[model samples]
Each structure stands twice: as C-alpha cells, then as structure tokens.
Target: MDNFWFNQSDYEYEVVEPCTYQNNHSVELLVGQYVHSIICILGFVGNSLVIVTYAFYKRTKSMTDVYLLNVAIADLLFVVSLPIIVYNKLSSWSMGPVACKLLHGSYSVNLYSGMLLLACISTDRYIAIVQARRSFRLRSLPRSRLICAIVWTFAFLLSVPTFYFYNWYEPLHTQDVYMYDGHEKNLTTPQFVCEFRFTNNSTAWTTKVAVPSTQLAVGFFLPLLIMTVCYTAIIVKLLSVRNFQRHKAVRVVMAVVVVFVACHLPYNIVLFYDTVIMFQHQMCEASDALQVAKTVTQTIAYLHCCLNPVLYAFVGVKFRNHFRSIIQDLWCLGKRYIAPRRFSRVASEVFVSTRRSVDGSSDNGSSLTM
Candidate 1:
C-alpha cells in the first residue's frame, strides 16, 4: 500500500490553473478500505498459521522448506504492519517518527525479502529436479541457513534508505495533496501524513527518481529475470522426463510462478511507470484513474501473502496431513473424514506408529508437534 501511494503533489506540474483534484469516488474509497481490512485479517491469520506449522509441527524439513520458513517469517512480520497501512488509509498518521519509519521500512523489507526468497526457492527446486541424480555444492542445511541470513541482512540494508524518505509531513496545500478520501478530507484537520517526501529539488532526484528506480530494478526486475530463467529451464527438464508426474511437484512449481506474476507484477509495473513519470516530470490528467488502478493492484498484491501458504505449503502432500492434524487437534475432533485412507496393513500400522511417536499423542490428548 505504501508502494501504491503516488501523491499528486509528489509530482511537479508546470501549468498552473484553478484545478480541483478532489477524489469524488466515495464508493471506491469505501470498497478499498473494506478490502484493506479483509486483507489485514486474512494475511495475519494465514501467515501466522504458516509460522506455527513450520516452527512447532514439522520436525524434518528440506532445503526448500527452510527457505519457506524464512519467507513465512517475513510475511508474518509484514502482516503485523498491516494496521499501520490501514491507519494511513483511514486516518492521518499521529504515531511518532520512529513508528513511521519502522512500519514503512518493514513493508519495504517484506517486498525485497519475499521476492528474493521466492527466487531462491525456484533455484533450489530447479537444482533438485533438473539436476536429478547429480551432486551440487550448496544443497545442505547449513548453506540454506546461511542463504536465509544473507537475504535477511540484504533486505534490511535495502530498506535503510526508506527511513530517510518516510517521515511525517504537514500539508502545505490540501487541494494539491489528494490524500486518500477515506481520511474524510476535513477542512479543519490538522495532522501530518506519514509518507515519502522529496522536499526540494536537491532531494527530488534522489528520493523520487533514484529510490523507486532501484526498487523496481532489484525488487521486481531482477527477481522476475531469475524466476523466468529457473522455471523455464525446470519446465523443459520436466517435459523431457518419462515418468515425471504432472500433478506432483510440477504443479507446485507452476502455481508459484503463476501466483507471483498475477499478484505482484501489476503493482510493480505501476511503480516502474510512476518512477519514469517522476523522472520525466510529466503532467498527466489521468492521475485519478492511475491512483485507483494502483490501489486495486496493490490490494491484489496483498493476496500473495495469504496465498503463499496455500500455493506453496498446502499443495505439498506431506503438509496436507500436517494441516489436517492441526485442525483436528485444535477442534478436539478426531481426523475421521479429512485423512487419506491407508489400504495396506503395513501402511496403516506405520501411520499410527509414526503419528504417536512424532507428537507423543495418547488415547486422550495430543501435542501440536507432527
């Protein structure tokens, strides 16, 4: 949502006239706010479940799962910041400077960390599948942890500049600001809008031009290129295999790529366009339309945080059993309908033995472990 805030005043206009840039879209504003609340709640619950699943339930995990655990950690952190975003949309920012920077910077860190992690997952999958029966160097758990640490470090460093740009700025002219209408546009409202500001010509080139340029390049374009190369090569190798199951690991790979392109690409495109327009200092009359588009696309982008659990984790055969076990345990309802039936005697005996051994379950009680 912070990425979608393209304040019209953030852009310079050479032609001056008695212009009234009031957002008369009350219905759209209400709908966007409703979507904001829904995404906040759903993303929080979904990502929290992901963290719980990986932390307390799953005992053994692959290298891909390790990356996913860090991804879930990033999403959970970002989901907690959703209230800040909703508050910005619904009211003026009253929280102090530290809170503003922390909230906005966390959003930036999420953007950078999530994409980089997904790219890492794709690369790992490509190696595991395409390089089947071959040995690779960085395939161990230690290396996986090191990769995650590096990603977290890089993500925090990437957001360091955001602390400089995002600050509470008083309204110089309410008419030109074009704040979110959900703020009510009170004529007597005396509050600061926490946002990224260029301040003057000296900082404009760096804040407006450079920051967004770097964001689009590293946050979107570079990840897009990496994902494209990895997934394409992976698909080629899968097609050549004689016994590759179409509905197995392959479907999960396709889902990841499809979800990424669908949810995040439009927002990134709008961001890239905004950066270019700012650098060119062009004046456009379609600011209202562009604002609505950006808001909608960014809201759609929030779906990715919720969908990561379903698309990546729930799609796995092993995770499905773990999810069912957790749900059954939470409700105190035994798994009578959701679990798959084991036909062979040996398989059923193994399932019962493993379930009891893994979670220390008794005839009466069970733990969260799986």
Candidate 2:
C-alpha cells in the first residue's frame, strides 16, 4: 500500500509499502473546497482593503508602513492562488506542468515572504520602542525598502527547490484485484497529482529532509524566534515606561505574538512531525491521521492572512480614521451619482463635515506608533 501525505504549500509526499488503513478523501475535499474557499474570500477582501488604504489614504512615512504594504501584497498574492489550488484539488491538473510549478512555487514564496515580513515588522517595533534613540537613523524609509527587497530575494531563493522539484505527474495506483480462470489480476488507475518529483533515489534525502527542514527553519522557526525575542524585549521596555498608553501597547504586542503563534504553530508542528516521519517507517494509521491533521492545520495557518489587516492595520487609530474617510468619500460620490438632486446637497454637506472631523482630530494613539 502507498500512503500519501498532502501539504497545501509543501505539496504531497508518497510513502510506499506502508500498512494499509482506510484513507478519508472526504476530509481533503471538504477543507480544500469549502474551508479554503472561505479563507480565500476573507483574505482577499482583508488584504485588498489594506493595500487600498495604504496606497490611497496613508503615505509610507515610516518603516512600518512600508513593511505592512509589502505584507499585504504578499498575502494578496497568496490568497489569489487559492482558487486555482481548489480547482486542482477538485479535479485534475489540467493547467499543465508549467502552471503547476509556477503556482506551487509562488505559493511557497509568498508563505515564506509573509512570515519573514512579520519578523521584519516585529524587529522594527523592537527598535522603535526599545531603542528609540537609534531608531530615527536606523528605521529610515529607504533602508526599509531595501530590507524588503532583500527579504523578497531571500524568499525566492528559499522557494527555488519547490520550483525545481514540483511537477505534475501521473502515479499508478492499484484499484482492485479480480480472479479470472484461477489467476488473480490487479487493476490499476493513473491519477495526476502535483507534487515534488525527484529525478532519482539519490535526491530523496535532499527532497524529503533537507528541503523541508529549511522551510521549517526559515519559514516558521526563524520568524517565531525573532518575534519572541523582539516582542519580549519590547514588553520589558514598555513595563519600565511611565506612559498611560503603555498598557494598551503591551496588549497589542501580546495580541500580535499570540495570534501569530496560534495560527502557525499547529501547522508547523504537524509539518515537523511529517518531516521526521519521512525518514522512518510509520504505520498507515499514523500517516492517515497526519494527513487529516495537516489538511486542517494548514487551513488554519492560512487564516493568518485574513487577520493580518485587522491586527496590523485596522488596529491603528490613524488607519481606521483614514479608512473611514475613504468610506465617507465613496458614500458621497455614490449619492452624487445615484441619489436625487435634492439629496446630493445633503450628502455633500455630510461628507465635508466628516472630513473636517477626521482631519481635525488629534488622536495619535496608533498601535504601530507605540
């Protein structure tokens, strides 16, 4: 029997000659089709709103703004790939090998990039708050943009293995057996699956262990370590402060760290376990359980993209005010185009008043600023 391990971003792994257990295909379908669809929708909307708000309403005045914009772009690209991935899961890979490599590689790239960007954000915060005197010169906008470029380049390098190894291949599976004329014959079916396909057995170790270890280290563990250290120091600094907003700042930092861990930890744990099991023989039951866990946890990790805007952008008072202003402007424009001529005047007056209120406000308690 051959057992299959399915990872949404890492692709699938096939283990041959495993003890047979009933594999539930419905779980994959349910999560990939429905749960992933919901995530895709929410992620698209949330990331898009962040991008639009940043592009139109807010200027990239600080390093945090630049990092947030890049994070939104990375997440947006990740969510955009979901529909294609869902289609591939529901049916077969009709999009061909080029599309296969590009889609999977891009997914891996964005996954790594998003996590790395979060780490960058955490480090920036630590510098801004914990090392305030040096932050002025260190956190310049040009330097931040350069750092973002370096991050993207490094993420692409991390994803090179996926691009090289992933391809659409048809694997033969034993469907059934029939006895005819005292002879037993096996029936086999070919199913096209998008997965990492090595050229030979010599590359198995590299693909199975090294590649995944790199992903786990750079994509999850590295970010987690950076965030943990940076946020810890930041909280300590906040505790020593006399500012009233210190408590609020501490809560926001805790929320960011908690959400990051809650979203990615389960999936990374399962991934690490799966990576380890690749080297050893495992029972079919264990592999089956791992598959189900991976499917569910991977989707949970994807939910982070949807919450990024809420946690990083909308949490800031300035961003919320800007977003509100955008909405008001849209509403006034709609009224001018669609409402009665008498109502247009009222809409214009309302829009002007709202703009004045937003522009005149002195509320500078932005979560990122702290």
Candidate 3:
C-alpha cells in the first residue's frame, strides 16, 4: 500500500494513493458492504412487490393511496442506485463522469422524496381524522396530484447540488506544473479523488454546523415534530370517539406513524452525529475511528431506502393483502401445468373464504381487522 495523499493547494493537483485496506479498515469496510448489500436486495424486492400490488390489487382512486404509490416509486428509484454505491465501496469509481453524477444525485432524491411523502401522509391522516367530513371535500384527486408534482419538483431541485459537486481530479505531489488531459499545465498528483468543494472560503462551522443543522431542523426534526403533534391530536380524538375503531381510519394512521418512526428515526440520529462531525476539523485521534464512524453513518443512512418498502407493506393490512395476492399469482403461474385443476380450484376457494373471514363483513370492520 502507498502512503496517504496530502492535499496541495499551490498546484491544482492531488496525489493518488493505491487502494489497499489494512486489517482493521478491511473488517469495517466489509461489514458496511455486507449491510449495504442486504439493504439493497431486500429494499428492491420489497419495493417492487409493493409497486406490483398497488398497481394491480389496490387500484383505489384515493389521495392516500396515491401518496403510498409515490412512496413505493421513490424507494424503487433509490434502491436501483445501490449497485453504484456497492461498486464505489469495492473499487475506485470505474464509471465515467456522467454516471457518477447521476448515481450520487439519486441518494438525495430518495431521501427528500421519502421524507416529503411522509409529510404528505401525516397531513393526510391529520385531515382525514381531525376534520373527517370537511377533509372529504378539501383533499381531492386534483389536489393530491398537484401536491405530488410539487413533491417531486422539490426533490429534483434539492438534488441538483449533488450532481454539481461530482468531479474527477488528480492529486498533487509538489507545488509544480504537470501534464493533464492533453496539455502541459500546473497539475497536482495523479491520484484521483471525488470531491465536493462546497465553499471556497467555508469554515468547519459552515459545512458541519450550518448545513447539517439546517437539514436536521428542516428534514428530520421538523417533520418529526409535525408528525408527533398530528398523531397525538389524532389519538386523543380517536379515544374520545366511540366508533373510531369502527371507521378504522384511526388505526391506519397509527400504523403509518409507527412505521415511519421505526424505520427513519435511527438514521436521523446518526445524521445528527454526522452533522457534528462534519464541522469538526479532526474527527478523532485515530484514522481508523474516523473510517469506522463514516462506515456506520453511511450504513444507517443507506438503510432508510430499504426500510421504507418493508414498513409500508407490513404496516397496512390492505398493502399486505395486495402483496400476498401478487405472490400467489406468481407462484401459481409456475405450477399451473403440473398442479391438478381440482387442487387449484380448492386452493382458490379456501383463499377467498379465508380472506372474507379476515376482512370482516364490512369495510369498516376490515380496516382494523388486520
């Protein structure tokens, strides 16, 4: 392994170090990669299942359903970018400039989109529960469509900076000139680094303190506050009402809130730590410690993309039913030729009967049944 690359500002070049891992770094990196792989695979499968089910079984024309669909779509798009992250971990970026920008920018899209959808879901439930009758007239299909458009637009705009930051640069060894591209120029060393130079005269306070603090306030902290207040009000109103369970609307809201908290809260806490670290000049005494922290923070953040799908499918009874139906249909397709017609008929009958029993006699009962 080569020595560490030193940043030289005199010459616009950087020293490139050969990629090799020490034992400690190797273990930490391996663990992170393993977790990343699990998240990518499971997130993809789960989100894909939700998308298929939402498209086929629960084709209801409701605003809440539309928001759920958006959630699934965002997760799918985010997880698709995981392969690029995996490659970045195992080796130096082999993909060209365009690919790097697109791939890295996707991480922001998933984060913002998922959070926006959560906010939408919370607002939806708040309206549906707090002013049940009034909300029916207020939250219409067109409004939902408009909100979704705004959400996507906002996400795309926020992610533009990510693409802007991506660049390929070589390292500089001495404060001297060198050949770069096709011309003789003042260049750094040949070691390439993917850098995002946020500010020309930015301090640790700005990068670590200001940016992340704002993100925490707007992204995680504010959303959490709104969700808590809305859900609290909802729960109180639900308790006061005699037939809240009969409507099952309250139950659905509870499930959504619970899952959102479970899947996302940990990552936000990790982000808080990262924000603090971002501002600090020295992360730790040892290089290994810094690397370990990076691995952990990245892993926690990345896991959110995977968790969104699983939570949606498991939290809502309707989502689970829709998912099961798709799975059954896929399974039957493979075995239809070999299986007897009598067996298939019996299975179908049993499934319908069991579903009716579980779903209850009425939609109201079915809402909270699962």
Candidate 4:
C-alpha cells in the first residue's frame, strides 16, 4: 500500500501485532480539533482585517502594502483549508478526489506564495530604504503588481505536484480471521485517507523525498535567507541614521525575522530529519516518535499564519491607526443603523478628530513605520 500521509517516511516494517504502539488517538483528536479550530478562527479574523484595511480603507498603496495585501490573501486561502484538513483528520475525506486535490493544491500554493511575498516585502523595503533614490522606480506600484502576478504564477506551478498527486484513498486494514465453511478469511475494513499516491513503486523517491525537499528549499530556506540578508542590512543602515524611530524600526524588523524563524524552524528541522530517514530502515518506535513530532511541529508552524498580520501589519503605527479607523467607522455605522438619534454628537467629534490625526500623521510611503 502507498504511504497514508505526506509526512510519513518511506519505510516499511513488519506488523507482528495490532495495537503494538501506544494509542494517542485522544491527543491527536484534541490537537486536530481544538487547536486547529482556534487557529482557523483567529487566522480568518486577523487576515480578514488586514485584507479589508489594505483593500478598502487605504487610498494609496505602497509597494510594501501591495506585497502585504497579497500575503494576507494567501494566508486567507490557507486558513480556509484548515477546516477541511481538520475534518479529514478526525473523520474521513467525504469530499472525494477532486475536492481533495483542490484543497491540498490550494494549501500548497498559498504556503509557497505567502512565504515568497514576505521575501518580496523585505526586498521592497531594502530597495526603499537602503537604496532609496537609486531604486525608486524599481518600487513602483505597477512593478509591484507585476511581481505579485509572477509570485502567484510561480506558486501555482510549484503546487502542480500536489494537484496531480493528492487524492482520496481508502486503505484496507485486516481486522481478524474468520472461518467460513472450509476456509479461513481475513476480515478487513477500509479507512479513508487523503494523501500522495504515486503511480508505482519506482516513483517513491520522487514522492517521499523530492517533493518535500522542494517544499523545504523553496518555501522556507530561500525566503529565510532572503529576509535575513535584507533585514541585517536594514538594521545596519538604521543604526547609521539619526531618526528617532530607527531603534523601534530595528526592533520590529528583528521581531519579524525572529518570529519567522521560531515558528518555522522546528517543523522544517523535523521534516528534514524525516526525509533523511526515508533512506534507512527504522524501528517502529523511532517511526512513531518521528510521526508524532511531525504532527506537533506542523501544528505549531500553522500558528504562523495567525501571527502574520500581527507581525507584518499591526506592528506598524499607521496600520494600527487605520485599523482603528475601520473599527470606529463600523461602530458608528452600526449605531446609526440601529438608533440614529442615539448616535451622539460627541462620538462623531471623537471620530472626526481621530481621522484627522490619522490622516495628518500618515506618510505617503509604506504604512510600515519603517
């Protein structure tokens, strides 16, 4: 039988008995249901706010704004797939093969695009700050949009493997032996699982190693390297400047890099180890440990989606002000719709003053304080 999950290493061991390993069904269920539920809800809300603030409220969009808006869109797409994933883990993929491929393909596409857009954001910042006058034209709105188009196209291309390989599979497990008339028959039940299924054993290396390695190299390491270099230069530049916000800007950049590493590094490391072990035979205990680690670390990595808006957008003073304005406007609109007379004059005055302050303090450059 083919591997049941994408993260499972390519190895087979003799099954001497059923229930030989410790059961962690309850723990898996808890994490799959509760943890993922919370991530889905928070990621949805946070990314939605970012998208709304950038797409509707902002009259002028900077290069960074364009990159961030795409990042948020990628994140929202990924967040939408969480419920299906969680449900699949707990029960079965009732959605069939086409839905399975679409969901998994979309997940991979967004995962790659989100990370790439973040790298683009860093590159744009580097151009805008470190090489400002020399590269002004490079950071134009039209160019940024063109770059975003390329990112989406490239991401879709990268996800072609997932789209081709992922499908709903029902693997049969032998339960017991039964005597029927003169012969004994093995009774088995089928459990549905959505995973990568290769055409033949010859493609095991491609499915087990090449696919995941590509994901790691392109999705994590490349972007991490780009961000590290860009931010390091940015920090050095900030130190040479006499601006009061330089220190705060440096802090924000550091936080962004640190959080990215903290959230993704552990999972990538685990996945790397898992990939390496695919070549060697392993005991059941070792395999079990690796599988557990992959699940837990993967969940932790998923939290990064929820944290993106906070790290990228909400950290900016101007973005926060814009977000506040959106909230205030929604509040005022709700009050007016519910009870027009109850919409206090003082509330209107406060709202007007807030908008004035926001508009006055905002710059034509990136909403990011840097």
Candidate 1 local lDDT, residue 290: 65
**Model 2, span 106-153: residue lDDT tens:** 998998899999999999998888888888879888999999999999
lDDT of 1 by residue, 262-335 (tens): 99889988877776665453344466566667677877888888888777677665566667666645533233
Clash number for every model?
A: 0, 0, 14, 0
Most accurate candidate by lDDT = 2
lDDT scores for all predictions? 0.71, 0.84, 0.65, 0.84
The Cα error of candidate 2 at residue 75, in Å, is: 0.6
**Pairs with steric clashes in candidate 1:** none
> Model 3: how far is 354 from its true place, Å?
13
Model 2 worst lDDT window (10 residues): 361-370
Candidate 2, residue 337: lDDT: 89
lDDT of 3 by residue, 1-370 (tens): 8889766776686666543336436755676577767887888888887777666555535677678779878888877887676666455566766777778777677777778887777777678768788886877778988999998888778776666865655434323676779777764433444545454555434444654565567667767787888878777877787784534656665766776666566666766766655535652334445556556665665666666665544566656666676666656554554686746776666556654543442333111223
Candidate 1 versus the native: TM-score?
Answer: 0.78
Model 4 scores what on Cα lDDT?
Answer: 0.84
